[model samples]
Target: MLRYLFLTVTTLAIVGCSNEQPQALGTLEWDRINARAIASEAIVEIYAAEGDQLEKGQQILKLDTLLQQAKVAQLEANVSVAQWQLEKLRAGYRTERVTAAEAALNAATSDRVTKDRTYQRQLELRAKNLNSQNDVDSADNRYQSSVANEKKASEELHALRAGYRTEEIEQAQAQLTAADAALRYGKLLLSRYIVTAERAGRLDSLPFKLGDKPPTSAIISTLLAGDTPWARVYLPEPWLSQVAIGDEVSIKIDGRETTLNGRIRYIASQASFTPYYAMAEDNRARLSYIAEIDLLDSDAQTLPVGIPLQMVKP
Candidate 1:
């Protein structure tokens, strides 16, 4: 009979052991979230309104560049001129230009020769008493004038053959460089006028309108990055020891439980003031340590930021 009583007790004990439950040390409720505003070098011309969904690299603002556009046009024209100059310098003057200059030089040379002959004839006539001294002097002046004309024409021909001067090419090249930079600056300014979504996310505000000047360093707009959103949890001093980095925890939201892989990414070494909204029902003005629970890829987008959560602390 004693053996039967012992067997019955053993069976009941085994049943009780089978029904035993696991206990959680504590729980972390709610995720803390803050708004992140977009910033850039461009003037914020909002193409999309507050709450507008945006894709990455979409242009939302533009800067004024009429002056720069004109500058670009002027530079293009100068480039054509520079190209012509470079080509002319490399190939020498065109055949037609050189031919015309050569013709002028030849005409001048012929005139000089004819005048010299006339002067010589006049002098001989004077010596033979067949011409006046005034006539000889006039022929001599005419010959001198023709000689000067020939020299001038020869110099012009040489200049034409030289193409553009070294200094002129250098100056044009400099202008081209400056004009390029100016156009780039204008385009940059145009970029400044327009703002774009740097990352794919939700736009939160349009504080500054299309023409309104937004205060520098002030919140013009906000964006909440969709992918990789994390739930920040504040663990109490007593419960923190149970939760460490890389510990798996179970989180329940709206009665649906999901395993949130917690990476002890951030542990506030020093305790900070508890976020006002994080006021626990049992604790007031609690000094708490902050930790981040990374959401799983499937639940990342659906996880509500600052949602009151129940984390079954291990």
Candidate 2:
């Protein structure tokens, strides 16, 4: 009878131990996001403070934009000038200029005719021994000069009538397009001077205060992203095969009586151990796989991060 009682007690204790669920220890955490400065400009205004709940696209801070705005204005002026130049090219030469060219051509032709007549008269006189060789040479030179002037004027008139060349017009258009693109880029850079929140979350920190100049690409703000916190737990090798992503689990906070509901969201492919080369059976048991469990309850959103918790497998 004494032996049977001892056996029965041993059986009950073993059964109770087997019924206890396996638990993994972890801490509550939130996804962190950083907002960086696009330029090394002084912070002029702060729209949101640390710990403030922020909405997506909400203004977080403003950097000094005076210089950027001036640059944009200069680009705008260049765009305008380019536009005018393109318009001028497309319109071709003005009517008044064409008329002037025509008039110049006619005047040059009249002068050339007059000089030719004088040269012919001088040559005839020289042939009759009435004029010296020097006189004939001077008249010949004047006639040649007038002929060159007439040819130049005629070409100028023809160019005016033909208007701008196709290549010239295309070059002007390309310049305008380039200017417009530059202006658009300047405006985009100007917009970056005002920093805004990229996601809806609680503002965790503001590294720069008002009037503080932050270097380019420096983190200006930090946010704890997501509505609810997640549990960062390590799954022992023994339970690695039992749990998977999307599996439901129970979460017990260290100081809370009520348990929270969660679902496994991620599990590391590699196991984490102090010494990677340890292949002994005892060392293999020490390997733990990193995993993340997302809280499903709305109240979990208000929970503070870094609080100890236990994830109990269901």
Candidate 3:
């Protein structure tokens, strides 16, 4: 009976200790941000170097923009021309142009009248045998030519006063719309030439120096974020089952005297072998769930990544 009582007490103690123990163990880590080249262009200048601290949206590098600038300029010119054409179509012919066309028609009409009167005189002379048939024929040809000229001039005046055709106006409008869209696209392409940091962080690595033309697939630089570092830990199955996300815990940085408080931010749904940092003889063969702890105190910022830390479950 004494033996049975001792076993029951020991079982209770083991269960109680398991409840208070940390669920996972891992090293501190920070999220890395990468500045990648999004355009295929030659690098013109690098405003930043490795280890440079940068704010969000800061210019990290600039690609050669001469070609892009030229393209945009050309597109702008096209847009201007299209706009002028559309405006001219909408406004119709100018008053001065209409007046000129009318004057041309009137001059042609007067010439036609003079030619017709001369041809009639030649016909009367031919009938009296005072003029040869060849003279009548020449006058007749001149009259006919002048009549064609008058008709041509009259058509020109009619066209000038009638304004642009509906189809022509619509075509001009479409051209203007197309030109505007092309200009916008050219400007958008130019914007990609200036490479900017997507987040506030330290410039971790720059693969290319100034004047280097790197491939578009190459990462321009990697950024170590400025946020507080979090602990990346792996918990054995036993501890994994005991801890929940948002639970408060104590983190003691290895070789540090102070302990930091933090909350569990993540718990892996799948289990894997214990990572190298967390491996020990006792847990070497164990499957552990990965977990993350967000340090609550400012001390986390002072700590570097890969540092060992101990977490105590509260």
Candidate 2 clashing pairs? none
Model 1 residue 11 CA deviation in Å: 56
The runs of at least 3 residues in candidate 2 whose Cα sits more than 4 Å from the true structure, single-residue gaps closed, are 1-24, 119-145, 271-288
By TM-score, how accurate is candidate 1?
A: 0.51
Q: Which of candidates 1 and 2 reaches a greater lDDT? A: 2
Q: What residue pairs are clashing in model 3?
A: 25-233, 25-234, 26-233
247 Cα displacement, candidate 2 (Å): 2.1
Instruction: Give per-residue CA lDDT, model 2, range 1-314, as digits (tens).
Output: 99999999999987876665444777899988898888899999999999999999999999999999999999999999999998998898999999999999999999999999999999999999998999999999999999999999999999989989999999999999999999999999999888888899999999889999999999999989887899988776778878889999999987789999999999999988623322333344466778899999999988887888877765
lDDT of 1 by residue, 21-131 (tens): 322222332332222222233342456766666797765554344555575677667666666655556566788988999999999999999999999999999999998
lDDT of 3 by residue, 200-252 (tens): 87777888887787787678778888578888877777776578999988888
**Each model's total of backbone clashes:** 8, 0, 3
lDDT score of model 1?
0.64
Models 1 onward score TM values of 0.51, 0.75, 0.64
Q: Whose lDDT is greatest here?
A: 2
Candidate 1 clashes between residue pairs 3 or more apart in a chain or in different chains: 42-192, 43-192, 61-194, 61-195, 62-193, 62-194, 63-190, 63-193
Better candidate number, 1 or 3, judged by lDDT: 3
